[model samples]
Target: MSEELDIPEEGTESLYERRAFVIDKGQEPLRIDKYIQMHLEGSTRNKVQNGIDAGFVTVNGKTVKSNYKVKPGDEIILLSLVNPEHTVLKRENIPLDIVYEDDTVMVINKPANMVVHPGVGNFSGTLLNGVAYYLEKQNPGLDEDSLPRFGLVHRIDKNTTGLIVLAKTADAAAHLAKQFFHHDVKRKYTALVWGDMEQDEGTVTGHIARHRQYRKMFDVYPDGETGKHAITHYRTLERFHYVSLVECVLETGRTHQIRVHMKHIGHTLFNDWEYGGDRILKGTIYTKYKQFVDNCFELCPRCALHAQTLGFIHPVTKKEMLFESPLPADMAMVIVKWRNYIANRKEL
Candidate 1:
């Protein structure tokens, strides 16, 4: 898997499985689900329903309703096949903001909202997809079936954009992954949370797990199941009456580690849609700040989260490197105005 494979050219979603062939010509008249079951192994009716909801299964180059019948020559694109575990990622001439690269590794300034790889609601336009193309363009001798060449070393949340690294060679990938597994890499972030923390610096230690009632969340409780241990260290960069700009360093990585931990500590990032942080500001606690946040809401419509810094030792060279990004302007006012609000309140 570390070896690169030639990815397919970047294009819009296709109707039929791009490279998958029909099980039999006689099955043409069968229902789409049945056709999928017959052609694609381990695919079932329930799996098809799940795929449809996830927007993975499509027909004739377009996503269609589940019950839609198929006709002769109608291409049946199985979204599942595009999965990195299934198909080789292909090149599509996608643009990238390459920060740094060498014989063994590549570093990128990943944009916000672009998932590192395909998952959940995002099946395309992922960093993996882009990297696949980049690798293909770099090495023409590489075969397409072995594509998706860039060896993914680590992953960052889709919304928390920042510096991310990938291994270009299998040896580099395995060595880099070992560093992560052993907690050898250093990672950092800058975020605008909803409230000023009590202390200027702190660390959160907790066991995290998915909520029983909610399908898409994590919780830390006294009686919670034994979830994975995660640690985050934070320090205040700026404080406002209702928010704080904090720098966080990860000692461990887990799903929604920062978002969940901050929310657990009662300071979720503003505009976070999933971890209960999305809302329009209305109070006059700081009108200027409210206006700023409201305007940003209109502009970006994402939580004030950013993986502003990244550092790790080169797997091949053993040299150290680091990268950083400034806090996006959308969440800047959360700190600027809140500082004024707190100062004015002190004046009273």
Candidate 2:
């Protein structure tokens, strides 16, 4: 089954433009509203039904109601009648670390302290703005408004430095989006947690959602009570008594998945401010140790996490591709300090 949507240009009063799709021959008869909602990402049942009520949905060139039963070979067209909130997108000449670029996709190594996209309080100085500028410069005829500003197939946190994949064309965006949705993309992260795990390797599974009181943070719902399903598999690479370096492989990508999952299991990522890792979780209460930990925090001010590797199939050429990045200087330096501390302890 295939579905198509014509996305309206930025600053346009027409909320959504014309979009059409042909139902699969093997598809079962179902309500048109339900089918559309299921096919589109970030869509709700109420939104789809409202579109139908506004006479924006048609079947076989006839306007249909929300309850219209869709059969095999049905040609469905939807004229979006809702207003999309305008996002403040600006073009800034920010420097970008382009790892690879082709007609289909571009892989970028995003630095820490950089926001992936502009939203809410952040209206400028983002990776998206920089990328948009780069694309516009590459081709003068490119529509700055129609360009894939939100074409990021995946994103890292503002404070977490890592590799992020972006799609240049709509076809590449859809292909990469499906790969991420199906958990076919390989993602591995390196993190320094506050405690050493008893097991060398383990997996954490829970439902994750925004925290109840702290809207900025996330929490694990173990009983599947709320939020989306999340899983993180981790292996201890090295132990520094109070802190441990671990490699985390994501089975499901949820917001703050590695950070929350590690905190759920009593080993929060080192220097993570939100989940209580900023303060020392292990080690003695001596002034010397306190100063040492504080110095380490100064070395890596943000959460001690890095996206070390990413792998996916090429959207255009249909070839296997993989990329790896070494730990940023801050993370690598902190790890070296920990190794020296362990060495000195052994000598003592």
Candidate 3:
């Protein structure tokens, strides 16, 4: 028997597929939770238990408890959430800058302006859509329901360009998710922020939460009154007197952590329109200088941030893995412009 139930947003992970099974005629009794875990590659007993408690798992079309003992020829059905199957997922033929790929994981150098997944205003042309197409090629003749869903451990902003790792299998996704949750993964971002830094290095700690009024933006709640704990450690990479390029290491991953933390310290990312870095926040207001700044803005129109490096212990190898991507053309050009502007001013 098959049933499509209303998807509950909370208390459930994103589901990839629904599965049904029947106990062997001669099989002995086994706990439903353990039985499900044994059959599912990436699912744990706890996850199955959660499903059971939430009434996501049923026996003979009736919701059952985790400890329910299965009898011979008993019918079982599980509603697993997290990954949407291929039929519902939009597949695009977009090119992917694959950094590395194997049976377990894939790392891609995502470009600026590409959404990681589909949502609200972004219905297509996302990185995941492209990934679906790629995965379809790798696993041909597979049923649509059996196709692997996109396994994302973490995500960068829409405009933040650089390396993002994806799991190819259920086991890999579970392991990678654990690493991210425990803060075992190392993530580094390079950002060009407005204003000269008085200190060479510093750390920003605060609670980050959604803005009370602006639902689309995030803010740092300094009083620990709201939001999740976030930490960002930053060191000045190069200073251009008016603006500086900084490398930021994230201790905690929260929505807009780096962006909000930097802004909290009074150094907003350059060209970050949402955080008010798009205007002339530094340097002389002369016409020539204004034109120069405007030109730099045009050169790198998006937020001046890049996920430069990522390091983590490989789930399969138990060995360290590190990946890096150079600054894209837009960011590189703006950096050069800043360097020349600083040098020429010093010569005068």
Give per-residue CA lDDT, model 2, range 1-348, as digits (tens). Answer: 754544322111112335678887888889888999987566678767755664557799887889888997888876442233334457779999988899888999989999877666666888888988888798766654344322566678888988888878755755676577567888999999998787899999988888999999999986648877788999999998889999999988888899999999999999999999999999988798899999999999999999989899998789988999889999999999989987887432
The total of clashing pairs for model 3 equals: 6
Number of clashes in every candidate structure?
Answer: 17, 0, 6
* Model 2 spans > 4 angstroms off: 1-88, 148-150, 346-348
lDDT scores for all predictions? 0.66, 0.79, 0.78
Best by lDDT: 2
**Could you give me the TM-score of model 3 versus the true structure?**
0.77
TM-score each candidate.
Answer: 0.69, 0.78, 0.77
Report the poorest 10 consecutive residues by lDDT, candidate 2. Answer: 7-16
Candidate achieving the largest TM-score: 2
- After superposition, the stretches of candidate 1 with alpha carbons farther than 4 Å from their true spots are 1-86, 144-150, 280-292, 332-348
Candidate 3, residue 241: the lDDT equals 88
